[model samples]
Target: MVQSVKPNPQGGITVTCDNKEEHFDKVIFTSPLNVLTKVADSSLFESSKPKTPVEYLGVICLVLITKSSLTPYYVLNIADKEIPFTGVIGMSSLVDLDQTGDEHLTYFPKYVSANDSYWKKSDEELKSLFLEGVSKLYPDFDTNDIVSAHLHKAFKVQPLQVLNYSEIIPDVQTKHKDFYVLNTSQFVNDTLNNNSVVNHVEKFVNEFKTESNLQ
Candidate 1:
C-alpha cells in the first residue's frame, strides 16, 4: 500500500510504500481519482489539487459458470427496477467455447453509489439475489445448471459525468513539476470500457511525450 507522497528536497518526488520509499524523476499515478487524494499528500501539488467530492459508482459483479449458455446476445441491458443487476454480459457469446471447456461464462454487473448499502451484503446473499434476477430473465434457468459462481466488487469504478464535466476534470499535469495524474475518471465523453481505457492511455502517453520534448 502507498503510505504517502512528498517532494524531495533535491528533485523529483518521493513515494513511501508499505515496505520502502522510492524517489523518481517523474511519477504517474493511475489509480482512481478519488483514491489518490487519500494516499498522496495534496499539499505536494501546491494550489492545483484535483477537484474534490467527485461522485463515483461502485460495481458488484457476479461471475457465473454454467453448464449451458445464458443468452445469444453479447450484452443485455436491464431496464427493470426489480432487476438488481445493471447488465448481463454473455462472455461465452464472444469467447470460444473451447477456452471455457464448453461451459458458459456470464457476468451480472450492478452499479451502485459508493455508500450503497448493497455493498454490505454477503457474497452468498448477493449471489442469491442476482440468481433470482437471472431466473426471472430466463424461466428455464436452473440452479443446478450453475457449475460455480463468484462475486467481485470494485469501488469508484464509474465516475459520474455531470454537466460540464470537462471543466471540473483534473488536469494530467499538476502544479508540482514531474507529477501527473491519469485515470479512468478522465474518460468523460465516452463510456468507461476496455476500448476507452486504451484510448485514454494512448492519449496520455502521447501528451506526456509531447510535454517531455518541450522541457
Candidate 2:
C-alpha cells in the first residue's frame, strides 16, 4: 500500500510504498479524494488545499442468499423515508439463475453519513432491522427461506455535492508541476459511472500530453 507521497528535489515525484521510496516523473491519483488528504505528505503540494473539505457518505449493504426468489423486479427503490433500507436489488434477476444453483440473491443497501447512529449497531441489530424492512416490502417474506446473510460496509462511497461544488474542486495540476489529482470529485454535470470515468481519463491524458509536450 502507498504510505505517502513527497516532492523530489530532482524535478519529479517521490512516493513511499510499504516504507520504500520510488521516483516517478508524474503520478495520476485515481483513488477516492478523501484518501488523498490522508496519504499525501504536507510538503507534497505547495498550494493551498480545498477551502471547504468535501463531505462523503458511506454505505451499508446486507446481502441475503435465499432458497427461492424474493421479488420479480430487478431493482426496487424505497421512496418512503421511514424505511431503514433505501433500495432493494434482486441479483438473481440480473444474473443467470444457473450460476446461483437456482437460488435467489438479494441486496439491501442504506446510505448514511460517517457519524450516523446506524454505524454503532451490532451485526445482529442491523440484520434484525434490515429483515424487518424487507418484511415490510413483502408481507409474505419468510425468514426460514434465507440460507445465509452477509454484511458489508464502505467508509467513503461517494462525495456529497454541495452548493458551488464545482467551483471549490481542486485543479488537476497543483502548485507542484509534477503532481496531479484526478478523481470523481472533478466530475460535473455527469453521473458517476464507468463511462464518465473513462471519459475523464481520456480527456486528462490528451490535455496533459499537450501541456507537457510529451511525445
Candidate 3:
C-alpha cells in the first residue's frame, strides 16, 4: 500500500510505499478519488488540494449461488420504488454453465448514498432483506435452491454527478508538474464502466504522449 506521495524539488515525485521511498518522473493515479484525498500529501498539489470535491455512491451487492437460474435476462432493472435492490444481474445468463460449476449465479445490487442506513445493516440483516425482496419479485424462487449467499460492499463505488460538475472537475494535470489526478471523476459525458475506463486511459495516454513530445 502507498503511504504517502510528495514532490521532490530537484525533480520527479517522491513516493513512500511501505516505509520505503522511491522517485518517479510521473505518477498516474487510477484509484478512486476519495483515496487520492486521503493518501496524497498536502503539499503535493499546487494549492494544497485539487478542486475535486465529488460525492460517490456506495453499493451493497449480494451474490446468490443457486441450483437454477433466476432470470433468463442478463439484467433486471427494478423500477418499483418498493423494491430494496436497484437491479438484479444474472451472472449465470452471461457466463457459460461450465464456468459456474453447474450452478446459477445472481447478483442483487443496491446503491446507497453516504448517509444511507443500509450501511449499518449486518450480513444477516442484509441477507434477510435481500432474500425477502427477491422472494416478492420471483415467487417461484425457492429458498432451498440457494446453495450459498455472499455479501460484498463498497463504500466508494462510483462518483455521483453534481451540479456544475464540468466547472469543478479535477484536471488531468495538477499544479505540481509531476503529480496528476486521473480517476472516474474526470468522466464527464460517459458512464463509469470498464469500457469508459479503457477509453479514458487510451485518450489520456495519447494526449500525454503528445504533450511530452512538445515539452
Candidate 4:
C-alpha cells in the first residue's frame, strides 16, 4: 500500500517500503505520470501531472550474422515495405566499416505495433519470418548463412512524433511549496531532446537544491 501523509499536527510523514521505514523532510517524486496515478491520494501536495500524449511502435529486432560485412553504410534505409515497421540497421553499423575484416552485423525491424501479426507468433516462428524478410531485402543474403540469430524487444523505444506539444507539459515546480516531478516528457516530446533535457536538468537541480537546502 502507498504511504499516506498525516495532518499538519503530526509535522512528519511516514513512508514504508518492503517493510523498511525511512523518514525525510522532503521528497522529489520522479515516477512517470502514468505510474504516479496508480499511487494513493496524497493530500501533502497537489500537483497536476498530465498524461503523455505520445505512443510508439514496439520492436523485436532479429540480428543476423554474415561472413562478410553487408554494407559499409551503417544503415540500409528500407524505403517501403515488402517488410513491416521501418528500416534495417547493419549490425556492424557501430564498428568502423573501413577496417580490414570479414563478417557483418545486421538486424531488421521484426516487429511493428500497427502490423503486429508477428508478435502473436512463437519465437521460432518469428525468427523464420525475420530471416525470410531479411533475405528479401538483401537478395544476395542466404537464409542458411545466418548461423546464429537472437531476438531483442524494445518497449516504448521512442515516442511518436507529433506537433504543438508546448501547452501540455507544465513547469517542473508545482504550486505546492515542497514538491516537484520530473521526467523525459518535461525535457522533450515523447522522446528526450538534448538541449531541452540539459536545460531542464540544470534548472531542476538548482530549483530542487534551493527548495531542499542542499550543499
Candidate 5:
C-alpha cells in the first residue's frame, strides 16, 4: 500500500510504498479523489483544491450466476425508493452464453452513502435482502435457478453530481510540475460508466503527450 507522496525539493515526486521509496520525473495519480487527498502532501495541491470537496456515492454490487435470465433488457433502472438496489444489469443480454457455460449472468447494484446501514451488512444479510428484492421483481423466480452469488463493494465509485458540479471538479494538471491527477472526479458532464472512463483516459493521454513534446 502507498504510505505517502511528497514533492522532492530537488525535482520530481517521491512516493513511499510500504518501506520502499521511489522517485519519478512524472507521476499520475489515478486513485479516487478522497484517497489522493489522504495519501499525498496537501501542500503540493493547495492551488488545485476545490472550493467545496466533491461528494461520492458508494456501491454494493451483487453478481449472480443462474440457470435462467432475469430480464430481456440489458439494463433495468429502478426508480422506486422502496427497492433495495439502484438497478439491474443483465450481462447475459450483451455477452455470449457460450462464454458463461450457458448460464445467466446478472448484476444488482445499490448506490448508498458510506455510512448507510446497508453498507455495513454482512454478505449473508445482503444476499438475503437483495435476493428478496429480486423475488419481488419476478413472482415466479425460483431460488433453485440461482447457481452462485458474488458480492463486490466500492466505497467511492460514483460521484454525486450536484448542481454546478463541473465548477468544483479538479483539473487533471496540478501546481506541482510533472505531477498530475487523472481520475473519475474529472468526469463531470457524463455518467459514470466504462465509456466515460475510457474517454477521460484518452483525453488525458493526448493532453499529457502534447505537453511532454513541448518540453
Candidate 6:
C-alpha cells in the first residue's frame, strides 16, 4: 500500500521506532506547524502555503515537601521576575488527605527557561534553589523544615502568542486531491478547546459531503 500527504514540499521525516515497513492510504499529522512544515511535501499544495510562527518556553516546577501547612490557595501565579520562577501551590488544595493536624507546606518555583544556569545544576542543587525561593517568598520560612523534594520539567509550557494569528487559519479540505490537514494549535487564538477548528470541522463535513455528491 501507499500513503500520500501534502502541505509544503520540503517534507522530511524519520521514524525513530523499529517497526515493520507496512504502508497505508493516508496520514493526518496533528503536530506543531514548525515540525509539520518539514514533513510536508510542499509541492502538493501548488501555489502558496500559509505559515505561522511559534515560540515555546520551558518550565521547571519544584515541589517542596515541608512539615507545616502553607496557604489555602491552590494556584499561585507569580508575575514578578525578581522572584526567579513562577508562583507556588499547596498540594493539599487539590488532594484530600487526613488532616494529620501536623502542618504540610508544599510549593513550587517554575523556571521559565531550561537553559538557565540553574537548570545545569544537579537535581539536589535544583531542589535547594527551590527551597531557597520559598524562603525568599516567606522570610520566616526555614529551609531546614523541608524533608522531601520533587521536580517537574515541561517544555512548551507557554507558546509566545504571535500577532496576525487570525490571518493564517487554513481549511482542512484543500484544493489538492485527497489532501486534508487539521491542527488544533492553528485554531487556538481567541477561542478555547480549538473552537475554530471545531467550526472548521463542521464546515468541512458539509463541504466534503457536498463535494462527494452525497445528498
Task: Give the best candidate by lDDT.
Answer: 5
Candidate 6 or 4, higher TM-score: 4
- Candidate 2 collision pairs: none
Worst 10 residues of 2 by lDDT: 40-49
Sorting all predicted structures by lDDT, with the top scorer first, yields: 5, 1, 3, 2, 4, 6
Residue 144, candidate 1: alpha-carbon lDDT = 92
Tell me model 5's lDDT, rounded to 2 decimals: 0.85
- The whole-model lDDT of each prediction reads 0.83, 0.82, 0.83, 0.58, 0.85, 0.58
- Tens-digit lDDT string for candidate 1 (1-215): 88887778898899999969999998898777656777777755532355665688889999999999889988888889989899999999989999999999999999899789898899889989998988988888888999999999988777888888777776644667778877777776798776778888888899999999999
What TM-score, computed on C-alpha atoms, does each candidate reach? 0.77, 0.72, 0.75, 0.56, 0.77, 0.53
Q: Comparing 3 and 4 by lDDT, which wins? A: 3
Model 6 has an lDDT value of: 0.58
Higher-ranked by TM-score: 5 or 6: 5
Query: Tens-digit lDDT track for model 5 on 1-215?
Result: 99898998889999999979999898998788778878988756753668788888889988999998988989888988767898999999999999999999999999898689987799889988888888887779998999999988888877888999989976544678768887777776798776778888888899999999998
**Which rank order by TM-score, best down to worst?**
5, 1, 3, 2, 4, 6
lDDT of 4 by residue, 87-202 (tens): 67765767764552556677676436645676677878777776777667678866666656787776544344456665555444443344455666554543353456678779
Each candidate's number of clashing pairs is 0, 0, 0, 2, 0, 9
lDDT of 4 at 96: 60
Local lDDT at 178 for model 6: 46
Global lDDT for candidate 1? 0.83
Residue-by-residue lDDT tens digits, candidate 3, 50-128: 4667788999999999999899988787878777899999988889999989999999999899899999889899989
Per-residue error for 133 in candidate 6, Å, reads 1.2
Give lDDT for model 3. Answer: 0.83
Residue pairs with backbone atoms closer than 3 Å in model 6 (clashes): 8-41, 8-42, 9-41, 9-42, 9-43, 68-103, 68-104, 68-105, 69-104
Q: Distance (Å) between predicted and true CA of 181, model 5?
A: 1.8
Candidate number with the higher lDDT (2 or 3)? 3
